[model samples]
Target: MLDMQRRKAMQKLALLGGGMALFPTLDAQAKMLEKDVPKWDEEYDAIVVGSGYAGTAAMLSMMDRGLKNVLMIDKMQYMGGNSSISGGSYAMSRTSIQKENGVMDDPEMHIKDTLKSGHNLNNPEMVRIMAYEGLDAFNWLVENGVKWKLFSRSGGHSAPRNHSVGVGSYITRPLQEQIIKRGGQQRTRIIMDELVYNDKGIVMGMKVREKYEFKFDRTFDENDNKTGKVKYYRANAGVIIATGGWAADPKVRQIFNPALTPDMPTTNHYGATGYTIEKLIKDDIDLIDMQYIQIMHVTSADEDSFGFGFRTITGGYSYGMMINPKTGRRFINEIADRRICSDAIFAMNEKGKNHPLLIMDVNGAKTVEIDALQRGIEAGAVYQFETLDEMITKFNVNKEAFLDELKKYNAYVKTGKDPEFGRTFFKYKDEYITIEKPPFFVTRPGPKIHHCMGGVRTTVDCEVFNKTGKIVEGLYACGEVTGGRHGYNRLGSNSVVDCIVFGRRAGFAIAERYQKMVRS
Candidate 1:
C-alpha cells in the first residue's frame, strides 16, 4: 500500500479497534465514559450523540475551533456509522472536485436536480443551504485526507455528482481522524437511551447506555438457546443526536410507518435501530417525513433467493432493475428516487413472494462495489455460480422465461437500443454491449435501512426547535438524525454533505452559545 493508503488503513483499524486517533492509543484515555457509567454522570463542553457523518463532523469542527471540553461519543466502535457502510458517495454543488473535472455544475442546477429527484417535496430553504454549502464541505473532506472520486449514480444528476472514496473504504474516516487529533473524545459501544432535560425544560444532555443488536451465543442447559442481553450506554451534555434513521429496525418502521412491514428489506446498518428517534417522539419531539424510507434494489451476497434491494455502487453508471418471476420480464425503471426504489422493491416482494432479480450487466457489474464485500468476503456480495444457468438454477428464476428474456435483451443490444426500457444510450456509460460476461453474477439485494431523514428538526443554523419553532436551549442537531431537509426523497450522496455543512453550523452554534453563555 502507498503511504496515504497505509495511513488510511491503520486509521480504519483504529476505528474498528476503538483506540486513539489515526490508530494510536492515548497515554490517558477519557475515563472510558463508561466509567462514569450508570453512576455519577458528568458533563462536558459539548456532547455529540451518534457518531455517523453528522456527529463526527460536529465533533471535528468543535475541536478544531479549539473547544477543549468537547466529547465525541457513539454506540459503535468505528466512527463511520452508516456513512461508513454506505456507498461513500455524496452530491455536492460547486465543488472543486466538480469544477476540476469540468462538470459544469452550479448550486442552482444542483438544487433543481435535487428538487426534481425529491419530486418537488423538499424544504426550499434547507435544500438551498445544502446545495450552496456542499462544495466547501466536500473540499474540507479532501483537505482533511479524505480521498473522493467521481461516480454517476441512480439519481438523475446531470454531471455525475456522486463523489466517493477513490479507495474502496469509506471517505468519512479520514475526516474522523482529524477530529480525534483535535482532542475530541470518541467512545464506541455507547447508546443514548433517553434525552436529559435541565431544570428549565431545556434539552440538556442525554442518558446514554451500552447497546449491541447482535444476539449473543446462548449458554443454556436443558432448554432452547437463549439470546444474550444486549449492552447499554449513556452520554450527557448538550446531546446532539446523530444516530441515523429507522431503516434497519423494521419494528420501528412498522411502528411508525405501519403500512410497511418490518420484514420488508433495508440496506441500512444493523445499528440503525432508531432507538433514540422512537424515544424522542415519545418525548413529544414532533417530527417531519417519518413515512420516508430509503431502500435499494441491489442483490445480497448471503442468500440465493434474490428479493432484497440496496446495492452500494462503487463507480460507473448503475441503479436497479427488478424482474418479474413469472414471465422473467423487467419491471420499473432502475433510476427512480431512493424512496420510490425501496417501495417498488418491497412491492415486488409483496406481489411475488419477495422474489425478484436485480439485474445489471458487465459494465454495470464493474461499477457495483460495496467495500464491505472484501472485509466480509465469506458474506459480502460473494455468490457461487459458474454460468448464468447456474445462477438461474440456484436462484430459482423461471428457466425458459429468463433465457428468453436474455436472448431478446442480447438481440436488442445489437440494435443499439433497449426497446423494453428506454434507458437512453448515453445515460448508461459503457453500455451493456453484451451480457455474455463469464460468471454473470446475481444475488439477493436485501432491503437495507440506509438512512433516516427524520430526527431533531432544526433551523438552517442547526438549532433544535420545538413545535412552536423556538430553539431548544443548548440543543442542536445535524445529519440523518435531523429531518425536513429532503422531503419525501433524498438525492444520491447528499446526506454526507448534509452532515458536514450542517454539522459545522451546529458546532459553530454550540461554540458561540457556550462562549456567550459562559461570559454572560
Candidate 2:
C-alpha cells in the first residue's frame, strides 16, 4: 500500500541520521540530479501553495479567468493559514463606505501614507499597483460574497479607510465557499517538499507530501522532519507560492533579527514558518528586506496569542492614549506608526518594569465591536472603570499626573495639535477622538511579533526574480511569501490589500500565460 511505502520511506530517512538537513543539500543535489525529473502522480492547470487570503484570491482569480483545473493546497490541516485569525481589516481609498462616512481619501493619499510608513524602502510600483487596484480587489470580494463594513483607519493612514468583516474568517470563509462552488479543488495537510524544475530552469511542478502532520515540538525545523508521504504534483501553468512569513519560528526570526528571541510572543500560528522562503533562497532566489520583521504594538498582555484582546487595541490605541502605569504619564504618540509605538513601549516597559495601560473612555470604547469588547472583558484582557479614581486606585498610579496628562491631551485634541507627541487624530467628530467621556476602558498591551516584511522579490505582476535578477519562468509569488511591498515597516490593514491585489494579479497573469501557451 502507499501508506506502507511512505512509512518505510520515513523510517529510511530517520535511519539516515534524520532528514533534518534535507533542504540544505538542495542546491548541490539539484545540480547533480539535474536530469532526473520527478514522476508526477497528479497534474493541474495551475497550483497554488497556500490557503490564506493570497492563495484563495489567486485560485478564485484563476477560476474567474477560465482556468478550471486549478488546485490549492496548504501544509496545515486547517485552511486560511495565518489569515484565518488576522485582524481582517482592509485599507483602501475612494470607497463608497469612506464617502458615506464623510472620509475624503484617494489612492494617491493611500500610496503616500504607505511610503511614509515603510520609510520609503518599498517598491513604488508595487505600492502604486496595490493602492490603485485595491478598490477593484475590494469590489471583487464583495461580488464574491464578503460583506464588508468600515472599520477605523489604522495606524499610519491619514484617513478612515480600513474596511473589515469582523474577523479574517469572515473574508476567507466566504471566498473559500466561492472557490468550492466554482468547482475549484482545495486540499489541506499537503506540504510542498521540493520545487520541480526542468533543465532550462523553468518550473514544471512541485514535489509534495500528502496528509502532512505538523510537528509542534520542532517548530523551527518543521519541514526537516520526515512525516508525510512524498509525491509529485505537476503544474501545467506554474506554481504560485503564497506561503506566509516566519514570525512564529524564533530561530528563523533570529536569523534575520537577532533581537527576536524565542521568548517573544508572536501573533502568527505555528505553521507560519519560513521553509518555503528558505527553499527559494537555497535555489538562488532573490530575497529582499528580510531584516524588517514587524512587531504589533497592541497585543494583549493577558493572552498568550492573538485573541479578543486585539479588539482592545482597535479601540484603545486609535481612540484613546497609552500611559505608563509607573509614571502615570503618556510616553509616546499613541496613534503614531507601529514601529514608533512598539519601540517606545519596549523602552517604557524595560524602564518601569511594568506594562503600559491603554486608557479609553466610553466614546473610545464605542469604536470596538460590542461582542469582541464583551469577550475581551470576560477573558480578563480589558478592564472597565466608572471613574478615573477607580482606575487610578487599581493601577496604583500617580492620580494627579494622570489626570493632568489627560487634560493636556484633550486640549490638544480640541486644537488639532498634539504638541507633546504629534499623534495624528481621526478627522471625525470630537466625541470620537477626545478621551474626556466617563466609564473608562483600559488594556495592557505589549509588542508581539506580527508580520515579516521580507521574502522573495517579485515584479509588479508577481513574477519572481532569481538572485541573478532574472525572472523565474513559470514561478510566481504573492502575499507574505514575496517581500519588497512594505519597506522597513508594513502599515496595519495594508497586508490584506497587498495579498489580495497581488494574488489576483498573479492569478490573471499566470492564466493569461497559460492561454497564450495553449494557442502557441
Q: lDDT: which candidate is best? A: 2
lDDT of 2 by residue, 1-520 (tens): 6336435544654564422222222252342122464467998999999999999999999899999999999999799988998878999999888888878899999999998887666787889999999999999999999988556878889988889887788988998999999999999999997888888888888888898998775244875668889888889999899998889887777777777778888888889987777678777888877877999987888787786788778678887888998888999988888888888898889832588999988888888788888999998899999998898899898888988998988888778788878777664454437777788899988788999987888888889998788998999999998888887689999999999999999899899989998999
User: Among all windows of ten consecutive residues in candidate 2, which has the lowest summed lDDT?
Assistant: 17-26
lDDT of each: 0.60, 0.84
Clashing pairs in 2: none
Off by over 4 Å in 1: 1-41, 99-102, 166-169, 209-237, 299-322, 350-354, 359-364, 368-420, 427-439, 444-446
Candidate 2, which segments miss by more than 4 Å at Cα? 1-35, 217-220, 427-433
Superposed Cα deviation of residue 380, candidate 2 (Å): 1.1
For residues 38-88, could you state the per-residue lDDT of candidate 1 as single tens digits? 543556777888777788778777766667777776665556667776666
